[model samples]
Target chain A: MKISFPYMGTSHIVVSYLFEKLGFEVIYPPTPSKRTLSLGVQYAPEFACLPFKIVLGTYLEVVEKGAEILITSGGCGPCRAGYYGELHKRILHDLGYPVEMIVIEPPLVEPLDFLRKLHKIVKPKGIFNLLHYGRIALEKLKALDVVESTLHELRPLALDKQQINQAYIEGLELIRQADSVKEVIEAKKAALEMLESVPADHTFKPLRIGLIGEIYVVLEPAANHDIERLLGERGAYVHRSIFLANWTRDNVLAHGEKDIRAMAIPYLNQMVGGHGQNSVGEVVRYAEEGFDGVIQLAPFTCIPEIVAKSIMPAVSRDKNIPVMTLFLDEQTGQAGIETRIEAFLDLLWQKRKKQEAS
Target chain B: MQAYLGVDVGSVSTNLVVIDDDGNVLVDLYLRTQGQPIQAVQEGMKQVEEAIKGKKIEICGVGTTGSARTLSGVIVGADTVKNEITAHAVAASHLVPDVQTVLEIGGQDSKIIILRDGIVVDFAMNTVCAAGTGSFLDHQAARLNIPIEDFGGLALQSEASVRIAGRCSVFAESDMIHKQQMGHPTPDIIAGLCDALVRNYLNNVGKGKEILAPVVFQGGVAANVGIRAAFEKALGLKIIVPDYFKVMGAIGAALLAKATVKEKGETNFRGFVVSDLEYQASSFECQGCPNLCEIVNISVDDKVLARWGGRCGKWDTLSKTG
Candidate 1:
């Protein structure tokens, strides 16, 4: 069976591996680009969030390439994302594409149903082999996260940013090519070593900026217009609140502690759906950690993020941290975003200067 | 005889200013951009030279700011390339030393900058919306067949203010037409528009921002007395519009260039003769990737000067080295 999935940052690397292990021809969609976005935008319901349109575009692309099965995560929140699976399926059906769509809801939401769905897909191979392959995929994910985090930390300090970019690409390639847990571990070590060895001005002090927002735009560079790279290039240390591995461990494995969510209780006591509460919680955490500034990124017209954005100014005032929110969508111009970011950085720099003088 | 030149190439107009070492304005010129920024900039340079005919001013530094800052920087060899917000804030502070808030309405965008102790503390710009900008007012003026220069004077004659929707330009236009069809006076309609635009600016771009005094309002739209009065009536604070209101961005760029040159002890001024050079801007879609980024290349005398607009830095890097 040929299977396909949309790109969600580096998640595709590990996802394609798992599908190959499950004995399926995995044909993942290409990185979200202008062509894919237009295709998706052409047929998507007006006002759908950016991620939906991009993913829909990817599905259409893969369908054109003869992919028969499509696998996507199902959302379980009040946000519109929860209905995207059904909407996309309907749209594709209306477009006359005879493709089977598999929606994977969180296991905690429906444990028996989840296993039943899994049983239908996976061969009756022993559980041990499945576990082994899952372990390797998880390790690869962890390695990719480490490499990305390292790049974020070291990029601002590097004299030759090109070297850091090259190392990051090489690290991703190494992680993608590794077939076993041992090889993944070795690849991770090598990648880290290569990243750390890049020439850097260690004495430089970079302004630390925390990024918090909706999951899709936060993780996907294509969606957010490579904001992480832009911030890093401009001598700011970027600390993102989300990672694929951390999200999986928290959502799927349910292993992470609840302390982070607790941070939002003072401002947003209940679940407002999606990552709205998490964004507020992360901003509080970033403020407490003495970060220079915080930026919230989300797709335009996003409901949960609008909720978060409404309360951000109060959080910013109370915490005494500067916060800026950027809404990403089709109409987002790179120049406008860049100008705002530059002005935000200027504000941070001037604030720091005033503090030092005092 | 040393002076710094600043160019602000915006969507609607191009402004040029020359300031002496002590930051005294020597010359200021504002011209319509009219969709051709390159020609507008070159024409601005020629005019600046003509205006300072006998003044033996040496171009010690150059700066560029606005939407076309990067392109203007390449043409003039600017010592500083800064964004419009910072330039506006800097210029406001330079003129009104104790300015706490700045409300700037330009052609395509409007922004509010909150400053404390001469440092930018908070700011916000309208996102993908041009509802309450200079272009909005200009379009209405043109549609009403009233000369744009007479828009403010006519608006000032209103006895009763009509309420016009200003949520979006489209809605505002339709609402204005509806009001006109209802036999409302032109001055009242114009006055209503000014009020609606001010309300929209304060509610949207100026949302959640503390608009403290001494407030400075400067931009192309500041020339409109109607909008200025609307702002004053809304906030109940007297607005300060600098003498060089329309060219504040260029003045700010000049001020920044002065500071940059003071620090670096040198300048990147390519000289006034660059105005004589033939400049061309051309763009093509890149075929190497599915992104199909439209790459823009600016050249002078058939030699490529710079390339940009590509998501990947391949063409950008190639332009620099080649």
Candidate 2:
């Protein structure tokens, strides 16, 4: 089968490797762009969140490339994301694409059924064989996370940000081409060395800005207008709360929920659905870490993020940290976003100056 | 006299201010942008030249602000380019000295900036909504056949109060027409509109923001006394309107330029001759990648001065650093 998946940052690197190893021809969708967004908007419902539209556009592009199977994840929450798989299937069927969709629901919800579906899809020698490959794939994911986090840290400090960005892209490609666990580690080491080769100013301490919000918008550069790079270029150390590896560790392996839930209890007592509690908890954590500011990015009309945004003011006031929420949509312009970012950096710089003086 | 120049090319108005070394305004000019920022800026420059005619003033530094800051910065060879929010806050604090809040309603946007001890603490701008902005009021004034200049005075003449929805501009217009058909006087309706706009501003942009005392109201909309009265009534605090309310952004830019020149000991100003220079602005779609970005180019005598509006930074970086 020619298999495909929607792009979410570099998650595709591991996913394509896994599928290709499973004896399927992987057909990668083109990078999401203005054409993809416009196509998705033309076919999608008026109020669908940005990620949904973009994912739909990705699937459409893959279908044009003769992709036969589409893989997507599913969730059970109050947020509309839970119904994405079903809605995508219906929309695709209505549009006459007729591609097969496999939704991997959370195993904690229905382990037996999930294993049974996995068995049929894997069709391998045994479950142990699948586990071995899965472990290798996860190692690659970890390596990618490290490379990206390192890039975020070094980008602002480097004399040539373009050189840092180039190294990061080359690093991603190197990891994607590696086959074994040892190769992944070697690629990671090589990538870090590449970043280290860039000339940097180590004496300067840049403003610390934490990113907290919806996972798709936070991870996808195309959706958020390359906000991580924009902040880094503006001389701020960018720290994001969500990455594919950490997301998998929390949502799949089911580890590290206790700490976040405990932090969120003071403000958001319960989960309001997709990543709402995570956002609140991340803000509190960033505040405790003494970061200069937090920026919450969410798609327009996203319910979970909207709920999180409503409760952010109290947290910001109580923590004595400034928080800004930017609701992005197709109508968002680069000029407007850049202006807001410039103003926000000025605010942070002023706060830092006041702190130093007192 | 050594002076600094600040240009704010906004959506509706292009304002320019020339300030002396001591921050005293030497000359100011405001011209309607009218969907042509280049011509508006050139016209404003010409008028400023005429306004300061025979004065021994040399522009020591230049700055630009507002939505079209980048374009204007390139045209005027600005030493500093800043966003409108910072520019407004700087100007407000400079003028009022103790301004704790700034309520700025401009052509297509509204913002509330909170400051404490001469530093910005918090701020919020209206998102994806043009309901309570100056352009909406301008449109309504034209529809009602009342000149925009007399809008505030006519509203102040109302003897009775009415309510109109201000959640969306389209809904607000239909509601106004309904009230007009229901026999409510024009003054009453206008007063109701002023209240509605104020209400929208407070509920939307001012949400979750602490509006302290010593609030300064400025922007093009500050001239609307009806909106000012509505703000005073809503917040239950007296609002201070600065003498250079409409040109506050420009003043702030000039102040920043003055500061920059003092630190750098020189300026990048291209002089007043740039006002008469012929420049051509054009755009083309880039086919370099899947994102068919519409790249814009501004040229003088077919030599590209700047290019922007691309998703990839190839053109943008080339324009800025190359």
Q: Each prediction's Cα lDDT score?
A: 0.89, 0.89
Query: Over the stretch B1-322, how does candidate 1's per-residue lDDT look in tens digits?
Result: 9998999999999999999988789999999999999889999999999988898898899999999999999999999999999999999999899999999999999999999899998998888578989998888898989888999888899999899999899999999999999999999999999999999999888878889999999999999999999999999999999999999999999999999999999998898888999998989988887667788888887789888887656787754545
As for candidate 2, its clashing pairs are: none
- lDDT by residue for model 1 (A270-308), tens: 677778888899999999999999999988888888898
The reply for model 1, stretches above 4 Å from the true place, is A124-126, A255-257, B319-321
Error of 2 at B256 (Å): 0.6
TM-score of candidate 1 chain B vs. the reference? 0.98
Deviation in Å, model 2, residue B18 alpha carbon: 0.9
Off by over 4 Å in 2: A124-129, A253-256, B316-322
Measured as a fraction from 0 to 1, the native contacts recovered by model 1 come to 0.51
Please, what are the lDDT tens digits per residue for candidate 2 over residues A125-194? Answer: 4667667778889999999999999988898899988788888889999999988889999999999999
lDDT of 2 at A272: 93
